[model samples]
Target: MSDIDRSPKAPDLYVHYCEHQGCDNWGSWGKSPSAAVATRWWCFEHFPHKSFDRNRR
Candidate 1:
C-alpha cells in the first residue's frame, strides 16, 4: 500500500479550555444546540447542564 499521512493537524491538537473566567480546566464537554447558538465549553465542574436537572437555569 502507498504511504499515507493520518496525523492530526494543528487545529486538531488544540485543547479547548473552560470558558469560565479564571478557569483553566480542559473543556471536555461542550454544547451547541443549534447553528445560531455559539458553542460553549466547560469542564465537569463548570458545565451548566446537570445530570439531575437538564432544564435548571
Candidate 2:
C-alpha cells in the first residue's frame, strides 16, 4: 500500500459576518446560489429574504 493519507480531514469552521456595510453581527443566514453553493451570508436584521416563522422566534 502507498504511504498516502486519504482519510477525510476535519471540517473547516468558518465564521461568516453580515454582508451589510459596517454590520458586525454574526451571519447566521446563508443565501445559496444553487443547491451546492452559498454566495452570501447575513445577520437576521440585514437578511433580505427572511422566512415568516423565523421572525416569530
Residues 1-57 of candidate 2: C-alpha lDDT, one tens digit per residue = 668967678878989999989999999987765677656888999887746345446
Worst 10 residues of 1 by lDDT: 48-57
> Model 2: what TM-score?
0.55
Give Cα distance to truth, residue 32, candidate 2, Å. Answer: 1.5
Supply candidate 2's per-residue lDDT for 41: 88
Q: What lDDT score goes with residue 24 in model 1?
A: 99
Between which residue pairs do clashes occur in model 2?
none
Instruction: For residue 29, give model 1's deviation from the true position in Å.
Output: 0.6
**lDDT values for all models:** 0.79, 0.80
